[model samples]
Target chain A: EAEVAQSPRYKITEKSQAVAFWCDPISGHATLYWYRQILGQGPELLVQFQDESVVDDSQLPKDRFSAERLKGVDSTLKIQPAELGDSAMYLCASSLPDSTGELFFGEGSRLTVL
Target chain B: AQSVTQLDSQVPVFEEAPVELRCNYSSSVSVYLFWYVQYPNQGLQLLLKYLSGSTLVKGINGFEAEFNKSQTSFHLRKPSVHISDTAEYFCAVSDPYQGGKLIFGQGTELSVKP
Candidate 1:
């Protein structure tokens, strides 16, 4: 089965440093998502993309976080000036254009801010 | 607006025992429900989903969930579980009209003891 791919399985950064996470969704998927998962909580949506266009980012902290899926295939999520509270696992998911709400997720990048 | 609530934060059960994880949602519009499982150090995997039609949906790994519209509930159940089944389960909801951005519950940690 095809799987979503992610880079930098783990990242450690200073509180004021910048960090980026990458994801490659399964081929032919038109929708992509970025999510943050705290230690004991479920994944929370940060941004969503539809064929290279942003569909929803209402919950994204635009001031410090930004995500892009330029060609609507792979995506990148960047966080500048990371804070301690920003430490978490960042997950990326994707689905087909006519998805029935089923999602395929990447392994995720674990971030830790010191 | 849509929100998901996972009633139990943790459920401890012995291997080969039945397990049930409860989930409820509140939504004013038509919605789709989903259940995802995350093993340690991994990303979320689709367990099952309820889009329409049958109230009871069977998913991979011998898991099943029943969607109750009147009660606003979608509970997951498994006849028997194993130690490998220990993981974090999450319930999520999405409004079909909102471009498929998911709202997730806190999560339920299923600890299948040997």
Candidate 2:
């Protein structure tokens, strides 16, 4: 079965440093999402992309976080000047354009800010 | 707007015992429901979904969920569980009209004791 791929399974950095996570969705998937999961909470949407265009990012903290799907196949989420509260699991998911709301998820990238 | 609520933050059950994780959602528009399981330090895996058709949807690992539209609930149930089933479960909703963006609940931790 095809699966979404994520890089940097673990990341540790200083509070003021920068951190980035990458994700590659399964082939032919046209929609991609980035979510943040706190220690005891469910994942929350950070950004969503449809092809190369962003569909929703209202919940994303643009002042310090940025995400891009340059070619609509792979995506990168960057958090500059990371904060201690930013430590969490970053998950990537993808789905077909006309999907009935099903999503395939990646293993995730865990970030720990000191 | 859509929001999901997972009734129990943690459920402890012995191995081979039946378990039920409650989930409810409030959405102004029609939406799809899903249950996902996440092992420690990992991303989520889809367990089942309710898009249309029969209200009872069966999924992997002998898990099933019934979508009760009138009550706005989609509760996950399993007749018997094992130690391996211990994990965090999430309930999510997606509005098809809003580009299928997912909104997840707080999550329920299922601790299947041996």
Candidate 3:
């Protein structure tokens, strides 16, 4: 099956360090999303992209986080000066534009900030 | 804007027993509802969705959900669960007004004991 791909499924870093996660969406998918899930909570959208262009990032903590999909197929999310509170699971998902609104997700990157 | 609420935080059930996970949503515009499952250290996977048509939607892993617009609820149910079914389940909402951005609930952990 065509699944969204994510890398570095697990990462541990100390505070004030930098961390990055990458995602490759399914082929032909036009919408891609990045979400964060606290240990006991559900996933929350951090950013969204439609064919290499950002569509929504209203909830992103912009001062510390930045995301981009330079080629419209794959994406990278970066966090500078990571804090302990940044420990969580980062999930990536992709879907077709104006479709049934179903999303296919990657295995996700689990980040732990010390 | 759309928001989802999973009333139960955790549900403990014995193997072969039926389970139900409750979810309620609030939205000003028309919306779509979804249920996703997350095994330990894994990304979220779609379980089922309710967009239109039949209110009862069946999904993978012997799971089903019923959408009740009057009650503003979409609850997930599994006739019988297995130990392998232990995981966190999330309920989400998406609407066109927000550019198809999905909002998720706090999640409900289903623990199936053998």
Candidate 4:
């Protein structure tokens, strides 16, 4: 079965350092999403992309976090000057252009800030 | 605006027992409902979805959910579960008008004890 792919399953960094996570969505998927999952809480959207264009990023903390799907197929999320609270699971999901709200997610990249 | 509410934070059930996870949503525009499951150290997976179909939707893993538009609820139910079913479940909503950005509710941890 085809699945979304994520790299560096785990990451640990010191506060004020930089961290990055990568994701490859299923082929032909036009919409991509980046979400943060805190321990014991649901995932929250950080950014969304429609192909190579951003659709929504209201919840994204632009001061420290940035995400881009340059080719609309794979995406990268970066957190500069990471804070302790930034330690969470970074999830990537994708859907087809005619998606009926169904999404396929990748095994998240776990971040631990010290 | 769109928001989701997952009533239970955790549900402990024994093997072969039935279980229900409640979810409610408030949305100004038409929206789609979904249920996602996340295993420990893993990413989220789509459990099921409701989008212009019969109110009762059946999904993988013998799970089903009913969409009550009047009550704005989408509750997931499973007649029997196994130890492998232990995981965190999340309820989410996506508004097409909002460019399909997903809004998620607090998760429910389902602990299926053997």
Which structure among the candidates has the greatest TM-score? 2
- Which of the CAPRI classes, incorrect, acceptable, medium or high, describes model 3? medium
* Whole-model lDDT per candidate: 0.93, 0.94, 0.92, 0.92
Q: Candidate 2, B33: how far from true, in Å?
A: 0.5
DockQ of 1: 0.79
Q: Evaluate model 3: give its TM-score.
A: 0.97
For model 4, the superposed segments whose C-alpha errors exceed 4 Å read none
How many pairs of residues collide in model 3? 0
Give me the displacement of residue A34 in model 4, in angstroms: 0.6
The DockQ values of the predictions, listed in order, are: 0.79, 0.79, 0.72, 0.75
Poorest stretch of ten by lDDT in candidate 4 chain A: A95-104
Q: State the displacement of the C-alpha of residue B8, model 1, in Å, after optimal TM-score superposition.
A: 0.2
Locate the minimum summed-lDDT window of 10 residues in model 2 chain B.
B94-103
TM-score for the first chain in candidate 4 comes to 0.98
- lDDT tens digits, residues A41-78, model 3? 99999999999999999889999999999989999999
| Residue ranges of candidate 1 with Cα displaced over 4 Å | none
Rank order by lDDT, top first?
2, 1, 3, 4
The better-scoring model by DockQ among 2 and 3 is: 2
Query: What is candidate 4's lDDT per residue for B6-98, written digit by digit as tens?
Result: 999999999999999999999988899999998999988889988886999999999999999999999999999999999999999998766
